[model samples]
Target: MNQNKSGPGTSLVGWNIKSWLSASVNTLDDADLELVYCGSDVPSSQCLSLVKESIPAWQSRAVNFDEGDFFVLSGQQKPVVIMRAKSPTEAQKRDAGLLAPSAYGQARDLVGRAVSEVRKFKSQKVNLRFESCQDREILGALVGLELAAYSYKQSVAAQPAPFPALGLSVKAELKDEAQAIAMGTNIARHLVNSPPNLLYPQSFANAVVELFANVPGLSIDVWDEARLQKENMGLILGVGGGSENRPCMVHLRYRPEGKSEAPLALVGKGITFDCGGLDIKDPAGMRLMKKDMGGAAAAVGTLYWMTQSQFARPLDVYIPLAENAISGKSYRPGDILRAKNGMTVEIHNTDAEGRLVLADAMAVAGSQSGSDKPAAIMVVATLTGAIKIGLGSDVAGFFSTDEALGQVISKRSQEWGDLMWRMPLFDGYRSRLDTNVADINHCATGSYGGAITAALFLTEFAKGYPFSHMDIYAWTDGERGALREAGGSGQAVQCLAGVLQSFGL
Candidate 1:
């Protein structure tokens, strides 16, 4: 299955992330427009003054300005946005509150609306003004503004219009890390939005190599079909049998100058285009299948930030990339495939291919940790629609065997505004994967608990380690405040990065 590798020659030609967007700190007086936050208890006079009396009477009512509400004032020379924030007493309670999961979520949504409003005027520069807000809150607002500014126009013909260059007006102390997180998210969005024709398995691997070419303490190795066969990755090879592009297992290692401890293992599911193999999907269902690799996009995007920030500990990232196309060689349902971990799986449905590829990747990640046994193993994937049905598209669902590790991940997700809900490992659901033949079935016979079954399947490979599986919908059907728009949302980038930093990694 030797195919011509068509992409840049060892250099990051199309992957250069520098020219995408830029952010800077400046004073409020020099800004082209202004954005302000008002608490729920703010006086009627203050609310009226913030919008410059341009809004209609009904729109300008004090009661209308509640937490997370947004209003625009366009009559003035410079447009101003007044967003309602938590009341002072509520803020104080949340600062020391035992349970306030919505604290950062409200801040993120409020800033997202402001970014959307600013974009309407095509203003390149913005002034963010919030009275008595903590530095962490400011950081969250900056992250939202930077991420909302992303627009992908790489394939336009004559000339697609360019997004207005974005600049931020804030104190100098709020410039660095916030910009890094935004840049990382934008990278994920760009990769996810790339055409599947240009971003095949091998091309995607090459892009990673080029993107991190000169990055210190970073090394990348890509295992092609031949090497995969030698290593007993039958599930990976079988799932990729229909495509000439072939599948590849990409390993990214990040070891800083003085770090020698075993790194945290992160695995991502990277199905470039999932046509469902012999069990082909409907034309409508297959439209956005190109985004199947979103899990891998988020993993690499998080690595980009970790390496750039020189995270304290090392990390190992494994991405199993392939295209599930249609051909005579396509794998069929009822076909039994053996994974690298020596587990035999009966394929109940060819469409359930993401877990197959991830099975081999997870085994590889687990083995790579050697005897140290990684502190935690986390896998991210767009693996199930059941999760969307259960949690909706706004939040990702995660499953973890370790309660302490799960709590840490949950808290960090809320703090970063990533919105992750912890689904149970539910050992009771383990028997749902029973099969008449082979060690287990690839998927459950019925649609119930698809998300849980998928996580249960993956857990078999993550032996002797604390594991967490994240099922995310990386594509947003529509805008949610300012944090995400109608395209690739880069769902788990911030959450994973926040988790790593929380572990002091």
Candidate 2:
């Protein structure tokens, strides 16, 4: 965040924040954080609300704890705060150890909430800082939580709210803890929340390219129908056939300073607006389709951090933007469309267009003849009703052929606060998407595992790429938890971003 009279990071220490308070206690000594509590003396539930509500005032000043200083607050005998310094100027480590991981996490929630509250006030400055160790999972998550919170508030039209030019600086080594990830999340959320009128395919592509203009080692490329057709990206072409806006396949790449450790490719489904094509949805259903490109936004957010940060991995992002609107030229259900992979897909559901765009992008991930590719490639898309039905809006659904990759991703997700559930990749479900006339059908014959079926369909074209896909809801509401605000939270950015950093490729 911005520097201020508020004292963001601890000046008492060398500013190396290896740890910080996690909960609210009635007395200063009872807790390491002024606004949060730690033990049974105070319920963590109350602390949660305290965090969300108390964010405003604290932005003007962080909890001031001194190096090696010993102090206690009344009402509870707790070390309300501590400052990590160059020397053994502090001893709250013993006190801090008293609390379990659950309490520590509660503290993270409070800290993140405190940081997020300053979002709307673009004029005044907010200076809140949270301390964390390098390996602490929630450390990065708290940082991301604040960004997600601030970004959510920024999306509101009325957000012209007077808090400050809110800035959050997390003192941690994790990927999401960095400012780049926070800034990128805000930008991606803006892209997702922007109206279709403003964010057409070309404009969106330009926006993604523009996002990398100042960032070192980050680059972008936009391809038109001709480039797609030349490369045999029929799936993207078929879906874009109906839109007047024209389609674009956007590519973004990020290479680290040294030799790449583990190269990773990212693919995002960017259907800027889905009118359902010749097979159209009702006006109500189409209203929120402007966010059909949420996957692209996530990809952009993830790769944005991947490029700008010191992640040792070579990260590349591919986004295929399509606007599925009806025209005489629109591809219809029952019309078999050819994919870049040379597989035929029966148009069981024209509205199932995200997969089509992703199919083309996945097909492009390989060499001209499907030779060399990244060590791993993953796709993100808000592509199905089944995922929504299964995971609900509170969580995301994902399926990966490689269980090991899924575990790593899951670990990062916990750190980033994105809830993801792994569904089955059982081959038995593949039959539901089987079609007689084409190589595969877009939707399953039944709704048994719709999300799994959609994932399977996308996998059909990801032949050479080691790809995993996440079905993100992208929309938010209902909970008032710390740092968790209502609106389009960049659902999976933090998870993959942290994983990207860890993999160093």
Clash count (model 1, backbone only): 1
- What TM-scores do the predictions have? 0.87, 0.74
lDDT of 2 by residue, 175-262 (tens): 3245546645655566676778878888887766654665555566789888988878888888888878888898876654666445
* Candidate 1 C-alpha lDDT tens digits along 1-505: 0012221122232533442224244444556677776544466346656665645555544335444366676544677777665543565345343234344456666877777777678776666776555667677776766666555653222354454444445565455566667677777777788889988999999888887766667788999999999999999999999998899999988777788776888998899999888889999989999889999999988987676553557888899999999888888998999999898999999999999999999888887635435767899999998999998987899999877778777888877778788888888889989998999998988779899999999999887888889999988888775545577888899899888887732
Which candidate has the highest lDDT of all?
Answer: 1
Report the number of clashing residue pairs per model: 1, 29
- Runs of candidate 2 with Cα error greater than 4 angstroms are 1-108, 115-176, 368-372, 478-485
Best by TM-score: 1
- Model 2 TM-score? 0.74
